[model samples]
Target: MIETIVFDVGETITRDDRYWASWADWLDIPRHTLSALVGAVVAQGRDNADALRLARPGIDVAAEYHAREAAGRGEHLDESDLYDDVRPALSSLRDLGTRVIIAGNQTSRAGELLRGLDLPADLVVTSGEWGVAKPQPEFFQRVLEVAQAAPRRTLYVGDHPVNDTFPAKAAGLRTAHIRRGPWGHLWADDPKVMEASDWRIDSLTQLTTLIEG
Candidate 1:
């Protein structure tokens, strides 16, 4: 029986479009510059790791982000709210005897957003705190350890195949592919990859039934 769940935050529980849309505006950098930098790092082309390895780095983006959350910022930048089904679905799962945990690369900025909202997270593991990012296999392992769950009995759900599905699949955890727009093309229609997921849902509302099954 499924007993635990390790969820990703950004696109999973929390709606992230608002914060991202305003990140460049607050940084005083052109959106294009920020986009290029993030794109380089995300695409693994510019070598952010190399840059950090060269220097211990005085600034931590995650830390600054946490501080921002503590300061009660991001409200002005944010407009849209979290998904309506997220909390009720999670609550239903918890009521069904599932212990839901969080595993993501986000800073504790998640706490800031979530503290005000009525959400439930049994335990949380983050890349900022774990020193490792998703799809690394170890990320899910840590979550399993923290949640006292065996991979065979737990499910890891997230919006990305490479970041969420690949690692959880390798770690022996069941997987749920949350298909969203934006990155849908690279993965959405690929039958081979889609076949790998235990379940695929385009909306969080579908989770209630998927998990119930």
Candidate 2:
């Protein structure tokens, strides 16, 4: 039985359309162009941040990130920024005695952002704090350590096939492919990717039924 549930932050729990759109605007590039850049990186099996740096050579990423945060100061996510199904599903799982965690390959502000939302997770960890990112086995190992979880008894939920599903499955955690966001929907039609997931859902609300079953 799955006793632990771990989630991806961006687009998995928190909707990222506004965030990515803001980044595009800041870069003075079309949103689709930005999306394409990310897609290109994924296609080439490269890390997302590395691709962005390669795209804009000599870009002062730290400065750019701080600038973005500064420009959006005192701004935090509201309910509208989360998917309709997130809160209730997480609450339901926790109510059932399942340990819940948010472990994502995310920016430094991820923990702060989730804290501001008062999420129901028992623990929240980010790549910035872990010093490792997903698709890498060590990241999942750290997740298991921090979660105090057994890989075989844990379910890793996310939209990314490569970073979340594949790696988690490899690490012995069952995987849920939630096809609701850009990365999720982007690979939704890919049979190979979809087949790799242990469970697949169109919406997070379905998780209640799955877990209850």
Who wins the TM-score comparison?
A: 2
lDDT of 2 by residue, 104-190 (tens): 987667777777788888998889888998889999999888767678778899988888988998898888998876678878778
Q: How high is the lDDT of residue 57 in model 1?
A: 42
Give the alpha carbon lDDT tens digit for every residue of 1-213 in model 1. Answer: 678877787667666556544565655556666555544454453433332222334656556565665776544312245666677777888888889887786645445445446466686556867877776877777878876777778888887677777778888888888776333334655675587688787776676676677
- Alpha-carbon shift of residue 2 in model 1 (angstroms): 1.6
Candidate 2 Cα misplacement greater than 4 A, ranges? 32-58, 70-76
- Flag clash pairs in model 2: none
Candidate 1, position 157, lDDT = 81
Off by over 4 Å in 1: 27-80, 184-186
Error of 1 at 11 (Å): 1.3
* Per-candidate total of colliding backbone pairs: 0, 0
